[model samples]
Target: MQEKDKLNILRHSRHDWMNVVQVIKGNLQLDRKDRVYDILNEVTRRAEHEAKLSDLNTPDLAYKLITFNWQWQKFHLDIEMIGKPIDCARHEMCWLKFFDQFFEKLTEQSDSMTDPNLLVSFHLQETPYIEFDFQGGIQDMKNMQEWLAEWKVSSSCYVENIVANEQELVFVLNKK
Candidate 1:
């Protein structure tokens, strides 16, 4: 990543922190101590998650995740990531591109829903593969499958799409 990009990310992160602080201050002024405490706990949990992501040493991935959390407003994303950082330099760009397309599709589908939830969990295994579990509502399953098939052909990674139910989909991207 370029120095300018790093600086921009830092600025954005700082601005987000300031906004969180402002919210806490507003709650305090309103004498909503419970709300303030809740906000603090949430912020702390998010900060810990961010720290773990940073430990992965993949700045691009970390930045994209942070930016996604800040930019996406329609759906709440709950990410649970475990395992040590796997060197994924070769697949970073491909993963990022896939995420962009996936999020775009998700946003289009979730626009009508009230408070949609997206749960993403990643576990980096000793077998040198990261298992990504995505559970959410999809508007069009056929379209998404077609897109993923196209992505599979373009990338060297093995893409597995498992349909758990009508509203839930799980994908596992294995390193080829």
Candidate 2:
């Protein structure tokens, strides 16, 4: 990683830590010890998840996730990873690009919704896969279909499945 990228990651990490501290402080000020404890536990859990991701030893993937969290402010994104992290250095950039484009399109499609929440999870197995659960509204199903078709043709990744409805859009991509 370049020094500049390292600095950017550090800056974002610091900002996140500041927010966590502020939340704790606010709860303390309000005499909400239970809430504070809950927040602490959640933060601890997230830290453990981060540690697990970091163990993958793929800086590009880590950087993409960190930068995504820092840059995208429109919706709440929750990421859950199961199983061990597989070394994906060979295709990390491709996967990162795919994720960026997918998230951008998801945000655009769901912009008019009142509450937009996205759940992205990855499972590492014999055939690793990533799933995106977007709880919002898809404005144009035709457009999404076309985009997915084009993406499928252009990328080496395989679309395991896609389920769309009035409430949410879910898709799974498997490494090919």
Worst 10-residue lDDT window for candidate 2 reads 151-160
TM-score of each: 0.69, 0.84
Tens digit of per-residue lDDT, candidate 1, span 42-97: 88877777777666656787777757766646677666567766655666766677
Instruction: Write the residue-wise lDDT of candidate 2 on 104-128 in tens digits.
Output: 7777777554577888787867667
The C-alpha lDDT values of all candidates are 0.69, 0.76
Model 1 scores a TM of 0.69
lDDT of 1: 0.69
Which residue pairs clash in candidate 2? none
In model 1, the clashing pairs are none
Best by TM-score: 2
Task: Report the Cα lDDT for residue 74, model 2.
Answer: 65
RMSD of each: 3.7, 2.5
RMSD of 2: 2.5
lDDT of 2: 0.76
